[model samples]
Target: MYRFLITTSKGLEQLLQQEIQHLLPEIETRNRPGQVVFEAELADAYRLCLWSRLANRVLLQLRSGKGETGDELYDLANKVNWSSHFSADQSFSIDFVGTSRAINNTQFGAMKIKDAIVDHFKDLFDTRPNVEKQFPDLKFHGRLNKEGFGIYLDLSGGSLHQRRYRERAGRAPIKENLAFAVLMRSGWVDAIRNGDESSAEIPVFDPMCGSGTILIEAAQYAAKIAPGLHRHQWGFSHWKGHDIPLWFSLLDEAKVGQITPSMRFLGTDIDAHVIEIAKDNANIADVGDFIQFEVADATQQPNTFEKAGYIVSNVPYGERLGELTELLPMFKSWGGHLKQAFPEWHLSLLTSDRDMLRQLRLMAGKEYQFINGNIECQLVNFHLDEKNCHIADKEQDNHSDFANRLRKNISKLKKWLKTANTDCYRVYDADLPEYNVAIDVYGDWVVVQEYAAPKNIPKHKTISRLQDILIAIPDIMQIEPSQLVLKTRQVQKGKAQYQKLDKSSDELIVHENGAKFAVNLHDYLDTGLFLDHRDVRQKVRQMSKDKRVLNLFAYTGSVSVFAALGGAKSVTTVDMSNTYLNWAKRNLALNGIKGAYQYPLVRKDCLTWIRECEQQFDLIFVDPPSFSNSKNMQGSWDVQRDHAGFLRLVRMRLAPGGTIIFSNNLRQFKLDPDLQDSLGLRITDISAESIPFDFKRNQKIHHCWVMQDDA
Candidate 1:
């Protein structure tokens, strides 16, 4: 029997473990912060790698992570029968992560084990094995922390966070794992499966389920479906030790447990466009019947939910979110009406600002305070009691309490923004009267949308006051503050542009992750920068130094910039559009970098460039659009369809010792076996993990590796 460890980032460990165990019930399952250890056949590893969604890597637990020093790491790795895993002629790569003091540099530590494996092969076979950085047939994993390190072969060869489901996204949308964490924290899983909560007898709901992550996760969890069952590989299958029949038997067992569930879980967002998106997501998840969503305000529809249920929402908070002065009073009225309307339904509202918490006078239950990504929010839950109606008589006092809380939160954000050095692109209710949400800008991005309450007075209309006073101040000050373009139930979302008095100067870059990044504070839906891929850039920094790095289909040169920063010998960034190539130069120059350090940003088509270029590269980062076309690169470019061709181009240009990190947003990808069969270059799926924690939404991202070898 072999032990397979399905690993995931923290928070979603339980959900993934539950799903894995449910699939292989006979396996001995043990859960940890980042992994789930189970005893299973090699075939089970193959099945899990292809199908598991939450696992970052499916590894064969060769060593129980008990080693401390780097030498001990090598000794432990060398202990593995090298011949049992890879042939003397074969190659491999080791990925180091979460190491402790014993292993300081991940790359340095990973190399030690790689050396050991090679030495083991040399000592036994009288010849050394090769180290393939790009796509090794076997991936050895070293996960170390305060405890020790776990040495194993990365069966999935990729992280499993990328489930590939989301087709589009909105600004600052919550991530899938965190969304799953939220649902898990809300006890929605148990409530849905049991048809009621331990404390309340009502249904669980997301009044503002923006991406349908909450609903989809709930359905997927309650049903005993393995998150990976829908995907193509189970990493274990790739290992020599994997047993095919055992893997299929596990799949068969999981399939038998599938049942159409009966539950009344629902979601509603005020935006109709998002409602359409939610429906699309529901269809893709195949849980359309299990969930229902529509356009309704969070406060408006709780009255419709006859049965008492949990009402949870990630509501508006910050200046980019728009002025909450009007919304604040609305919340008071909503809570009061909630008492008169649905006396028993519990309301749990999450907000970044503390003011929203006080405004939501949920008197009964205690609050669960935790950080959601970076936004610190409070999940205020309240159980309803009929007698609390007059208890609502403290309504006047509640208004004063809101005023006090509002002042504290406003001051807190004002200071937070200044220290964080962020920019402001969101000015809510700029056209409305008596609304005040003045946002400041820094780092050319909207990092803080400060909320300050407009002074109360028996004065002109609120919208008029906003246009004259709020907008006028910014206009008079010569600061161009763009109107907030958020999805709301209110009349219109406004046109997608900067609504300043004068034309503003803002440089926006749309990241492949679909994030709108900007260089200046101007009018834009967002400033395009994917901060989450910071680690990917970190990877490039280490690899590109003193080496020729190629960035294929490069978008604004994010990876290129990092590579240059890492002291790359020379860089050639390719793209079809001359416009983006120019922008890439500007982005690089903006960071005070200029020179042939990165030679000739090319405007040639990538497919053609790869075919024509006679040079080889030491490192390459390929992130192609899911679909696009140009004159030189005409017709459709589907990553799933064209990945093989792209890989061929990469393999052709890659240096003997080079590595290429190829990424795409295509949720499902099948390796073109013909490329491996016909071309003889090795390849593996490394996509599941390419999606960062912030960018994750099961199946939205896919990754792979292409490697060339020599005898």
Candidate 2:
């Protein structure tokens, strides 16, 4: 028997534990910061190494040893019975994780330990052991924790989480462990595993199953498919103490348990090509014989399953999905379909968009807050019935969010609106004046007036001031310009800029730098104009000439205009929204620019559009929405989750000498550091000077980066 520890991202620890627990009837799983430790015999370890979706690495316990420093650790490790683990002809490697007072240097400790093992062998058998860093027969694991030290042998070659089925990358795919948690929470897989695979007790359906991970998992579990049957190698096989006969017998036993289920799992995705990938993945996992995969829109009919079953969904939630207006209907439509078609089914929806969650008609039965990698998300469980259980006419949500300042200060503004002879408006007035902000929704314009005292004024001089409080309340918070009801807003204040073209425009400003060329401005109130990135634009402009440039989300084509103005031979501009695409065209015409915009006027969602294309530019520009949910783009696509996919998609299109400028306004912009090595992409943070002068609220409005492929 092998004792195995599977490591996962710190965030998915609970989820991984649940997955392990669900896998075996008496499975003992323990979790630490970034790992899940389990009691696995030789077979269990081998099975885990092959099948764990959540476990990052599976480590088998070796001889436990302790030490203070490198020398001490080496001396301790040297005392281990190596002859029983490996022969003199075999090679080995040592990996170390450090924390603690005694050993601060991991490499130093590993080298010392490696030396000790070799020297120990030399002392016993008159020959030193070989050091194989890349692929060693036996891998040793050592960790120097704050309190004490521990040692183990890495049984999993790559990592337990590496399902080995995904061909390359699927867009914003759910992590394996989280998928398991979602499945377990829904109770579908449990029913099947508990003796109901043939009954259709609750047909498990993943409507937005991109690559069919959950579906695959359910099929494997129902079929009694041991997760560890597909691996090429495991660390235990090389260990001297490994029970090879026991492992072989266990594999044969588990293999014999495979069921050619009549019809147990179903996975559907909207994108046809993606569905094909999911099918390919099922085949790779050897579950193709038992699982079914297909292409179907979760939001549309005919594709929707009417059978009372469990539905697990993860829809689009960000810019790639469209905007809030688009996302709202998607939620409503999905809710309507589920309620109408599957009354007996329960649903577990995983998403990060709070706005979308608020739109769901189903009363949330329970919710589990978990992370999908870096993003915080909610796993909302919906107990489905034919209708809302305690159903009543849902009132239009006229009440301000309590979290909204408007609610806190509603009474004060109520008084002011009456005195000021203002009717039909959102009034929020309070003595805690700092929190006071009043807003009136006039047809086309929303008049948001603020009240704050001026610093000081002489008694003789007339002084009046209206501080900007409604600044946080954007005019287009919930609707589009077409949807905008533009009743006139009558505010008793300074004259308006004659409705200063509130929408993004065609005019763009240019900033030039020597190394590359980029736009100083776009049509967006944000070129398509983020004034915060003035310095970055200056860098792009300077670097523009003779550089092939590509700009994504190229609103009003500002970057393209700038690159052209900077004398680049060609510039490509891609945007998903037609309004923005045409705006780019208009900006180009306004700037007297041409080239690159001729063919690739990508109207499809940027993420999807980029995924299908293969064209490279010397310098590529990527600036997408910080947060948006538009249905036209198919689904929500958060930049953070979508960033790597976007980078991968766009980098493949970049020329050998090209570079990509990735920018987003997300305040807590987290550029995945792993992207550098994982995607062969290098990003340099250029957020410091991206802000422009005119719109200077902060020195940094967004984080910008210059991404380059390895030369």
Candidate 3:
């Protein structure tokens, strides 16, 4: 029997060992973090490489010895006859790992091994083999660590994970072997063949299937198809010691072993473009007829199968705070849908965030830890029985506490709302420390903003609190679930503030102090109208009667819409993004205001446009972002660093004695004294005046100033 070593991912060593034991039962095996060593015959090695799904590489042991210096490593490598493995015409490459005291550089250690092989061949046959780094005929692997040195011939050409079927992959695609491990740990194979003939046809579904990796793997497993059979070449195919006839016989057996099983594999994704890519990959794997692809959202998965089977998915892990905010509510809604529609189906979710998994409220039966490309992750298996489907009273207690806080805050803000004659306002802003979310009212609609949780708090606990908040908002606010909008509040910098979180084009007309504007609660992190700027928009209306007005850095042009309605002689709105420019025009048309030159919307960088403008305005609204590095802009913009220069440009076009209303949401802002001295302008702080009564608790939400040239 010959000794062979198999390598896999760090946490999958045990599973690989079990797989090997099943294929070759009499083989002696030893396993570690990423490698499994075993004693088997050459035929068994060939069989293992052909059928093993969880292995990354298979290497045949050639030599092992202790070596501290480069010369000693060369001596260990030279002990093997160099000409037996491959001829002088064949090309080869060396892959070196680990470092020792003497072999500080891996490249230097590899060079020593190469020299020894070439010298041995040159002295014997008067010629040496060529070294091809990209696609070599023979690949050598060397390891040098604290234990000692090992030299082996890689029997598996490249990484076995490259199944050669996926011509392309989607963003953050999980490796094929990793997907196999998930299926094994989740009992997918056992569930399909549980002695009941009816179970053999149980359906498998992946809602967030990206490039259909899991679906292809499941189809292959159910149909009894070997993964390596799709590849055209392998490391052993060109080796001199390879038994060509024996390999073909095994290949023919694997091909004949593939059976047409009665299994339904379905995959769905939100992106239609990616669904086509997944279909192409499935066809290449020869499982196209077994699997079906469609475009569907995870929150509202289609119940296509009559009987309950399995729902396995690699859900999104929000690496950014904004993404976390968006995914939390989606997970909660998906959980509710599964409990209602597919009560008997089991779920196996893989994600980096355990809290996200807990949002489903289903008790996980078993959990396995894995490392997916440096990110630690968990695969949680849930048997969705009646016992786990219902929410326990203890979970309801958290929701009750949040509702009580919301009710008390609404009672306190009720009188102020009536006095101001407003239907939209803020009801809750972290009144209780444990429930950290901001609640706002837009008539019958409510928008909830979750503040970023502290790093020290356990992520699962934070997610639990968010789920509780979502459950309480509709009940306490006496509104339907569709009216509640949830978002995560983060300190956005650069163009991230304008990034679209969703593609819903739904818009609503909301009133603020007798002026009507459009508000889209679903499409963006911030609603089209800033509720804190309610009083500021009113101020713009009061100051813009029949005056030539210019709105700079106008986002969505809510203030510009107000200025036009207030009888401004001319309104010039300037912004960079065409999306916002078109939105501003729609807002204008919605209010029955229309004109070409009378109310023109310019799609240009406000900072650059201001320098080129010669026309004067009686009133200018300047609300620049706190920080912006948009690629369309000339240079980076920081409100604090570039405010003085930006204001100087605005002053040149300010019809003499024109008023500039400068506002931003930077909480810790202090106007530069040098700017005030250089421009000879009189400045008044109207930050307190701009805030509506609902925003009294957080007075520093925005900073506003009235600047006038005192020349």
Instruction: Give the number of the best model, judged by lDDT.
Output: 3
The clash count for each model shown is: 46, 67, 0
Give lDDT: candidate 3, residue 403: 78
| Candidates 2 and 3 compared by TM-score, better number | 3
List ranges where model 3 is wrong by over 4 Å: 67-80, 99-128, 164-174, 188-225, 252-347, 372-375, 384-386, 389-428, 439-448, 470-487, 492-529, 545-689, 693-697, 703-711
Off by over 4 Å in 2: 1-44, 47-54, 65-68, 125-127, 195-201, 262-264, 302-306, 319-325, 386-525, 528-711
lDDT for each residue of candidate 3 in 1-711, tens digit (9 for 90 to 100): 787989999999999998898789988799987989988888898897888899999999888898778999999999978788889999999988888778889898889889989998999999999999999998999888676888888888988888988998887788899998888887877777564888888888999998999989999888889988987778877789999989999999999999987878889999998899899999999999999899998788768797888888888887744355456657777887887778878899899888877668778899999888888999999987898778543446334667777777788887877767567789888867888888898878888898998888887777788867766676677777667777888878767878987777788887776666777877778887778888888888888998999999998898998898888999999999898888888888888889978999999999889989989999999998889989879988888888889888887788877789999987787888876777667889999988887788789889999988655
Tell me, by TM-score, which candidate is best: 3
lDDT of 1 by residue, 1-711 (tens): 787777776656777787677556777788987668878776666666645555677777777557778888888787778687667776677778766566768887888888888788778878987778886667788777777767887777656655556666444466555556565556554565555343333466777788676677666655655556655643444567666677778778778877765446688887888878878877776677778888887666646554766666666665433454335545655667677777766666666665554545657466555455566666666766776554643323324332333344445455544543223322222222234333333332233222333446533433333322332333222333343222222211222121231245545443232122334333333233434344466677877779989998886677787787788899888887665677678877766667854566888878777888899888888877666644456565667788877777778887887777776645465556687665454555554554443233333435545454432
Q: For candidate 1, what is the total of clashing residue pairs?
A: 46
Better of 1 and 3 by TM-score: 3
The TM-scores, one per candidate, come to 0.51, 0.57, 0.72
> What are the per-model C-alpha RMSD values against the true structure?
24.4, 19.1, 6.3
Clashing pairs in 3: none
